[model samples]
Target: MNLNNIHNVYFIGIGGIGMSALARYFYVNKKHVVGYDKTQTNITNGLIDLGIEVHFEDSIKNIDSKFLNSNNTLVVYTPAVPNTHSELNFFLSKGFYVLKRSQVLGLITENTFCLAVAGTHGKTTTTSILGHLMNECNVPVTAFLGGISENYNSNLILNGTDVSVVEADEFDRSFLTLSPDLACITSMDADHLDIYGDASELEKSFKDFSKKIKPNGKLFVKNGLPLTGITYGIEDDSDYSIHNIKIENGTYIFDVKTPKTVLENLQFNLPGRHNLSNALIALAMAVQYGCPHRQLAKALASYKGVKRRFTYHIKTQNLVFIDDYAHHPEEINAVYQAVREMYPNKKVLAIFQPHLYSRTKDFADDFAISLAQFDELLLLDIYPARELPIDGVTSEWLLNKVNNKNKRLVSKDELLLEIHKTSANVILTIGAGDIGEEVKHIKKELSIAS
Candidate 1:
């Protein structure tokens, strides 16, 4: 599909992080952009601020007349949208140039020198870091991030189009559509079991994605992953490794050992070893792409990080509040480790909102074990983003499995009250669903109490 020929671009689920990024990309490219989302959100508000029309309702009448012309309009829909979505069905019935968000991403990056980051975890952070590095080094690049970058305060980094940076998402095997010139896999954990049905199939998908790399192109893998390529890890013997790691004033000061030479005194402010590893792979990919190590180091240090990856809403010596998008068990463990490593002495109270019914049922034991690490826990009901509720899979069931004695299930209405009763100094609101919407209120209430 020639994007130049399409004058109008419409998004069916415009509030999603990935979809909004694409919307921004088209808007910047001078296309007439409009979209429909089920609800108004900060993302939709930001899009509206850019003069791109956005409506919340799914009615056909909500769509502007200009976008009804199939010849000049291209329709993009996310898989998360229901099959019964009226706008999506209308576009399909009209036989407009309809494409999945991933398909459109693949088409956009096909001609460019693409750098894609693929993994169950760390895709957003790794892609954001790489995008920042390439953009800082003055590479003519356009980056479509899966999350909003704090440095740019936007998901689409619009520098130039010669090189494209994107998160090669693996949901529904979406990354298969992207053929990247340079690619990296940060992890291959057993996730999205509802999609792949088992762990082995998920691993197979990553292997398939590795093959999608262009001929003679490079692939970077986390050192222990079951893939043959340049490997990166922290404080270990790998193709690209970080050593001399230490924290000073909450920022990491480490030296990266690449195949060529050691890049010393590199600074990254993001907490957690996972984020440090993310920075390492981004650095390794940038080094292989011929970006000067000196410039890359500066960019890595300058990166503020992707929003909700490990965002600190309130940080003080007396009280600390952090919000993160860690729905999977492995992600939860990473968050736990980071919190413990940073605040070893403080008592942490974790409030978690499980994301999906299938995921909760599939990894209930693992989630319980991960959540048990906290001193206290407040469990919320499943968000049920795409799936219907599964019988016998509930927050109370998961809470019972947790070994921690100080755990209880709470509703959103009771969340603030439960939080007030906790004696823990460190407060964490964790999940990937509408739990994020509570961050502002949580921060405000906690700030006043502190």
Candidate 2:
């Protein structure tokens, strides 16, 4: 199966962040790109605006005739698409050269020198930072990222062909499909219990991914992670470490101690120690790939961050509003920690929409403790992305365990009303699901109120 032979590329889940990046890759490469998604999103619209066709319905009839030829057409679907999806079933029945999104990503990067970033959290931010680092240094590279990079305004960053940077997604053990020349596992927390069922299996899967690295290729792991690799941390004993960390005007002024030398007074704009660690790993990867330390530091300092990962919708001395894609308990804790550090003692209002029922149920206690850190909480119903409701798993149930007097469950319609009711100074909207779609509305109302 040579990718060169494929003339038409049809994606069953083209609107997904990862899928849309691939769709754009195919379109930019002059393939006849078309696909179907269950909804029309900014991603799908961007593809359509570039002349790629997309349909929202799941019906088989919506598939264009140009993609019917088995000899020249390639069909790709995400794992999130159910087995019962009509368009996917049609493609499978017709014996199209169908592939999972990860499989196709693997095939595309198989020949390229790939740097894959894998983690339960921080994958997007790390990948984006790596992509920006390589690009800024004028390396010939392309990156397929999981989130839209604020610098590029797109998930697919195309520089040249010598290198590839991608998020090594662990949702369905998808990162294992990639054959990476260099890789990093920033975390190995328990997630996607619907797939792995337990944390031990999840850690084993991370180990499996490390073994897939090409011979003589390097692997980087965050300090204290079970996997052995070039280690990185802030103010810790690792192969790569950062120290003298201080926030000056909301930016980090730190010194990094690498095996080679110590670079001082480096600047980083993103908040959170997690992101500081993320930047360190990306810097380590770029330097390992032979990027100049000076150039890498400059790039990391300028990276605007991924759109939904600590994205600043409004930043003023009077009020600050940040939107983040923090679905899991660890992620939520990071957000609150960053918020508290940045604006200590301020009234921090966090409106969290639980991503999936299974996750909310599995991590209820952890989530409760994390949310309780905020001064006020507005919990929304669980956003069931690819799952049905789990009995006894609801926002009210999670809210009851929060152990905070200022927490309440609310609906989307009442979100604005509830937010308006609060006189909080710092506002945070955290989650991974459709909560992102509401960012615009929330930003607008906050701006108008200001």
Candidate 3:
């Protein structure tokens, strides 16, 4: 278990966001890093460009020979990989030291001052904000984020080695492995039912994560999230809250009132009240970590935000396009609020691709209500990332429950053509699936037509 003894690091699912971050970290540290993924992506290509060996096939032969030795090679894998993967089995049967992505994160941050952000939503944005705050304050911090940060243009932010920031994911109970010096739970909504089976079980898992904070550490929670922690919210009686909020030129400008300080005129370019809350939580954590109030305030104002989380693809007087990863019903509602608040007079069109079949079946009614907020809607067939189809849970069934008359179901192939025919002033592509793979094409088409 002594990491210093290992010379080669190999990943089973290296193209995944978190796993790629880890691979990049080892590569930067001058270790031999190689990985196997089922497919290639922009992320994997970036890693390859950095001289990290990456192969698409799952065969054991693709693994570098240096990593074949059990004593010197360390294996890491994502939970999404199947048990029967060829390369994974080779390492396992040969007695390589294997670790889950979460376990490796836990091991790396154990000796540092860790700031962990846990929630069903908002974890990536909040963690990215916290990392920016620390970096701006000249703190020696490293952050492993779930999404590519627009500010840093990378998921791994390496400032120094003394402190660390991480998104404490709740899926597969991964957050349980982290013991944070300071932790926050942004929201505890029911999600990932395929893993927990019910909302109460999900809440119980979060409570356990809250208890994992160090004895001397602090815990921040949304004001009324049914948890006992130092509270945070917007314009409410919490330890920290955003007050005097205003929007200028489509940006959020606000003041944060912490327990002992009222930081003034903190500006953020990201949209939605939910994002404002995310910024406030990050600000509070920075202050608690001894970052100067003025430093944290400046960092908040300068943050560009995480990509695909309310990302603006086009913004002209004649047209506006946004892409967001809002898979859950509550997340979609937040996206709806941000779009309507920003352009109340415009005719908004929402194009959503449901992520998972089980999730679509579990929250069909809520999804219908949230998607109905748009002036027009286009529902694509469920992306079905990890699940097979469920009977009677098609996009057509969900479309019928929507209140909007302008709604229609379309396949990914017909999406651009249908979009070309619509008279949309504001365009929003909302989903957590591979629909994001279509954002650039949609943006290019709309940009040229307009």
lDDT, candidate 3, equals 0.91
- lDDT (0-100) at residue 75 of candidate 1? 96
Structure candidate 3, residue pairs in collision: none
> Model 3 — TM-score against the truth?
0.98
The lDDT ranking, best first, is: 1, 2, 3
**Against the true structure, whose lDDT is highest?**
1
- What local distance difference test score does each model get? 0.93, 0.92, 0.91
User: Over the stretch 17-77, how does candidate 3's per-residue lDDT look in tens digits?
Assistant: 9999999888888889999988788899999999999989878778766876899889999
**Candidate 2: deviation at residue 291, Å?**
0.6
Output the lDDT of residue 317, model 3: 95
- Candidate 1 lDDT, 1-450, residue by residue in tens: 788899999999999999999999999889999999988999999999999999988899987789878998999999999999998999999989999999999999999999999999999999999999999999999999988899999998989999999999999999999999999999998999999999999999999999999998999999889999989998999999999999999999999998989999999999999999999998988888899888998899899998998999988888889999999999999999999989999999999999999999999999999999999999999999989989999999999999998999999999999999999989999999999999999988887887
Q: How far is candidate 3 from the true structure (C-alpha RMSD, Å)?
A: 1.0
Per-candidate clashes come to 0, 0, 0
- RMSD for each of the candidates: 0.9, 0.9, 1.0
